[model samples]
Target chain A: MEMITSAQNSKVKNANKLKKKRDRDKTGQALIEGYHLIEEAYQSTVKIKQLFVVDVERLDEELMTYAEEVFEINLKVAESLSGTVTPQGFFAVIEKPVPETTQAKQVLLVDCIQDPGNLGTLIRTADAAGLDLIVLEKGTADPYQDKVLRASQGSVFHIPIITQELSEFIDHFEGNVYGTALENALPYQQIPSQDNFALLLGNEGEGVNADLLNKTTQNLTIPIYGKAESLNVAIAGSIVMYHLKG
Target chain B: MEMITSAQNSKVKNANKLKKKRDRDKTGQALIEGYHLIEEAYQSTVKIKQLFVVDVERLDEELMTYAEEVFEINLKVAESLSGTVTPQGFFAVIEKPVPETTQAKQVLLVDCIQDPGNLGTLIRTADAAGLDLIVLEKGTADPYQDKVLRASQGSVFHIPIITQELSEFIDHFEGNVYGTALENALPYQQIPSQDNFALLLGNEGEGVNADLLNKTTQNLTIPIYGKAESLNVAIAGSIVMYHLKG
Candidate 1:
C-alpha cells in the first residue's frame, strides 16, 4: 500500500485542485469526502478513480475492491482536502457520470438557483420524488461543489443530474411544463398531476424568469396562509415535486 | 448619536456575549444580524434592546423609531459582532417573544432536531404553511443561534417558537397529532386534512422518537419513488405541512 503523508504530495495536490469548478470540469472528476458518499459512489455506476483514507483498515471491503487505486493519507492531507472543519478521514476521487441520452418522462428544471445548499436539497428531494432527470440552468450552482454533495446526502450519485441551458431544454421538452409563481397563477392543487411533466423552480429572490414563465404550459403557486412572504425555493420545490409525482 | 468605535466597549462586549446560548438565556436577549432580520424584529411585537449600525443612513426610517437605543459602530466593531464573512453592517439585540398562552389550532412539534440549518428551515416552512405554533424539544438546536436566525430568513420574527417536552405537550393536546415514520405508517395523502392538528417532526437521523410515535394519533410517511433512502427532514416536514394545511 502506498502512503502519502504530505499535503504537498502530487496526488494530494491534484485532488485538492478538484475543490474548484474549473479543475473538476477540466478533469471530469469530483472529490467526495465522508464514508456514506464514497459508499454511494461505489454502489452507483460511477467510476472511482482513487481513494484516500486515513485508516486503510476502516475502508469497506467492497469499496476497497472497487477503487482503481487507494492511498494511506495522514490527518494533515485529509484536512487539506476537506472543506469541513472536522474532516471525516475518508475521501474518494470519482469520475463524473455521463448524462443519460434517453428522454425523461418526469423532470425537475432548476433555473439560476444561487445557493449550493438549496440546489443540493432540490436534487435530493427530486431523487426521492423519483424524477427521471434534473436539468440545471447555466447559472445554477455547480453540483460537484462540496456543499452540494454533502447536502444531497449521497443522492447526487443516485440520480441523473446534468447541466444544460434551461431555455433550450424547455424548447424541446414535451410535457406539462409547470412553473411556480406568486401571481396570476392557479393554486398548485388545482392543477392535475401528469405522468410526463417538467416542474420549473427558479432563483430565491427573483422567481422563474418572465420569458421562461411565459413558455411554461401553466403556472401554479402554493397558497401562503401565513404572514411569511414566500416559501424557500427548496421547500417550495419539494412540495410541488411530491404533488406532481402523484 | 453615540458612536462605538472600539469592539471592547462595555455595550459592544455585552451585545457580542449574546452570541452564546448561555449568555442569551441569562440576559433574555439574542443578537441578530443583517438588514432584513433587523427590520423584521422592529416590525414585530418583540422588543429591540439595542441597535449597532455601521452606517446610520442605511437604516430604515421606521426601524429608527422602533429601536430603543441606536449606536453607530465602526466597521471593526460590526465585524467583531457578525457571524458572516461579510457583515451586513447591522445588528440588533432583541428580547425573545413571549410564547402565546392561548391554544393553537394548527401546531408543529419538533423533537430533537439537531441541525441549526434544518431547524431554521423547518421554522420558515412552518410559518409559510401557516402552522400556528412551533414547539421544540429541549435537545433541538437553539432557534436564537446565528445560523438558525439566518436560515429562518426572518420567519422567526413572524411566528411563536417555544421549547417544551414532546411527551407533555402531546398528553395535553386535543387535536390529531401526526408523527412521521418510514415504516408501519400510512401514506401522508391517505390521512384526511384536519383544521385542528399538530404535525410532529423529529431529528434528521432518527424519525419521530419511538415513545412519541406510540402516542401520536397516526404515523405518516411520504412515499419514496426513487433509490434514495429518504427525504431531508426539512423537505419531508415541508411536504406534510402544506398537505395538512389543506
Candidate 2:
C-alpha cells in the first residue's frame, strides 16, 4: 500500500486533469469515483489501474483485494481529484475499455447529446433495456466525463460504448436504423418491433442531423399528450428504446 | 416600465433570497429564469407577478404586455438574480400555482425524491405521459429550486404539483396506489395496465419510506438486464408511468 498526503501530489494533479476530455482521450483512461461506481467496475471485471482511498479502514475488503494497486490518500488529496460536492472516499483510475466490433442485435446510436447527465442517463437506460452496443458520434458528449459516469450509475462499465462516424456505422449496419424526429414521423408504437434494430437519438435542441435522418430507415416520434412542447431527449430516447425492443 | 440598475436594489435583493426555500415559501413566489422558462410560464397561464429583462428591446411583446409588473434591469442586476451559470437575459418572478385537488384517472405520488434533477425529470415525464396530478411528500426536493426548474425544462409551469403527506393522501385516494421498491416486488411490466393508479416513487437512497411502502396496494420494480445495480429512480418511474398509462 502507498500513501499520498499532499494535494499537490503529481498523481493527484494528473487525475484531476482527467476531468478534461483531451486528457482522458490522450491517456485512454478516466477516473471512476464513489463506492458504487468502483464496486461496479471491480465486479464487472473492468481493469482498474489504481485505487485511492481517503480512509483505507472503511474501504470494502473485496474492492481492496480486487484493485491492482491501492493507495491511501489524505482527505484533501482525495477531494482534489473528485468532481462531486461530497467525496465518497473511493476513487479509481481505470483504462478505457477498447470496444470490440459488435454485430449485436440491438444497438443505440447516440447523436450529438450535449448534456453529460442526459447522455449518461441514455447509456444507463440502454443497458437496462438490454441494448447490445452503443455507438457515439463525434459531437456527442464524452461518456467518460465524471458527471456522465455518476449519472450512468456505473452502467457505463457494463455496456459496450464505442465512438465512430455515425454515417459510416449506419451504412455498414445490417439492421433497421430508426431515427427519432418530430416532423413527418410515425408514432414510435406504430413501428412494429423487429428482431434487431438500431435507434438513433438526436441532440437536445436539434433532432438528429439531416444527413443521419436522411439515412435512417424510418423516423419515430414519442407522442406527447400534455402541454409540454417536447420531451427531454433522454426521456424520449429511453421510452422509444423500451417500446421498440424486440 | 421601471429601470433597476443596482444589484442591491430592494427588489433585486428580495428575489435573490427567494433561492432559499424559506424565503420562497414566505413570499409564495419563486424565481423563473431563461427565455424558454419565461416563455413557457407566459403561455401556460401561470401568473407572472413580475418580469425582469436585461434588454427591453429583446423582450417578447406578449410577455411584456402580459406581466402584472415588468422591470427593465441592467445586466449586472440580471446576473445577480440568476442561479444558472449563463443568464439568458430573461427573469420572472411568478406566483406558485395553487393546485386544485384532483381525482383524475392517472396520478403520481412522489414520496421523498431528494435529487432536484430527478424530481424535475419525473415531473416532466409525468406531464408528458399525461398523468393528471403530482403529489409530493414533505421530504422531496423543492421543485422551485433553479436546478429542478432547469431540469424540468418548464414542465413545472404546465403541471399541477401539490405537496401532502403520503399516508394521508393514500388513505383518501380513490385510485390503486403502486409503490416502487427493489425487494420482493413484482416486475413493473407484470402489473396489468389500469385506468387509474397513483405511482409512488421514494427517496433516492432509502426508497419509498418503509411506512409508505407498507401501505401501498402493491410494490413494483423495473427489471435490470445489465450488471448496473439499478436504474435511475426517475427513469424507472417514467418507464412505469408510461407503461401503466390508461
Best by TM-score: 1
Per-residue CA lDDT of candidate 1, range A198-217, in tens?
A: 99999999999999999999
Model 1 stretches astray by more than 4 angstroms: none
The ten-residue window of minimal lDDT in model 2 chain A covers A237-246
* Model 2 per-residue lDDT at A179: 93
Please provide, for model 2 over A1-56, each residue's C-alpha lDDT reduced to its tens digit, 9 standing for 90 to 100.
Answer: 78999878887778788889999999998998998888888878888888899888
What's each prediction's clash count? 0, 0
lDDT of 2 by residue, B204-230 (tens): 888888898898899998877766667
DockQ of each: 0.83, 0.65
Per-residue error for A50 in candidate 2, Å, reads 2.1
TM-score of chain B of 2: 0.96
Q: Which digits, one per residue and each the tens of the lDDT, describe model 1 over residues B44-102?
A: 76799899999888988778788899999999999999999999899999998887777
